[model samples]
Target: MAGVTAAVSARLKADEARRPGFYAAGSGPLPQVRGSTLPVMELALQITLIVTSVLVVLLVLLHVQRRILLTMTGLASALRNSG
Candidate 1:
């Protein structure tokens, strides 16, 4: 069984070797960068967070303003009707 597996593996490797090398890197796992991070990705995420926060704040303000307006109008009509 081991011999069959090794033969198959060798044949596959040989076939791969004969093919045009279109791939740039080796067929193994990429090197890990434990302490490193992409600066551009971080900047983009931060900007997105800031924009999302601003949009949320604006939406909340608009919602609260509309509610307040509705309440005030209702109160004014009630006061006029009562007095």
Candidate 2:
């Protein structure tokens, strides 16, 4: 089994080396700087949070307005009955 694995690995190495523009560096490729992506993603998340908060505030305001209107109408009818 080990011999078969070794043969397969050798074949893969040979095939990879034959490809165009292939160069083997000692330290390999440089590490990607993903620091920029973090801030951009954070900004997007913040914007979404702000928009969601605004919508929630608007919904609460509308609900309060509806309740106030119902209460005022009830009060007006009671006054009319008493008068």
Candidate 3:
């Protein structure tokens, strides 16, 4: 095993000295790139939030209107009974 290791090391050293430009040495491989859909994801989230906020506001306004109508009806009844 040690003899095989020595042979491989010697071979590698000889190869490295002989052909320095064999494996595209200095420039390296072209860079790989990947893109994410973060902007689309954020836009979707913002749209959802705006829609939910508008729905909540509409529901709150509906509740307030219902309460106001009830109060007005009660006041009208009280006035009719007193008069």
Which scores better on lDDT, 2 or 3? Answer: 2
> How do the residues 14-79 of candidate 1 rate in per-residue lDDT, one tens digit apiece?
777667642223567544556656666899999999999999999999999999999999999999
RMSD of 2: 7.4
Indicate the residue-level lDDT of 81 in model 3. Answer: 100
lDDT of 3 at 54: 100
TM-score of 1: 0.53
How do the residues 1-83 of candidate 2 rate in per-residue lDDT, one tens digit apiece? 99999898777767656774443343377445655586789999999999999999999999999999999999999999999
**Which 10 consecutive positions of candidate 2 have the poorest summed lDDT?**
21-30
Report, for all candidates in order, the number of backbone clashes: 0, 0, 0
- Say which prediction, candidate 1 or candidate 3, comes out ahead on TM-score: 3
TM-score-based ranking, best first? 3, 2, 1
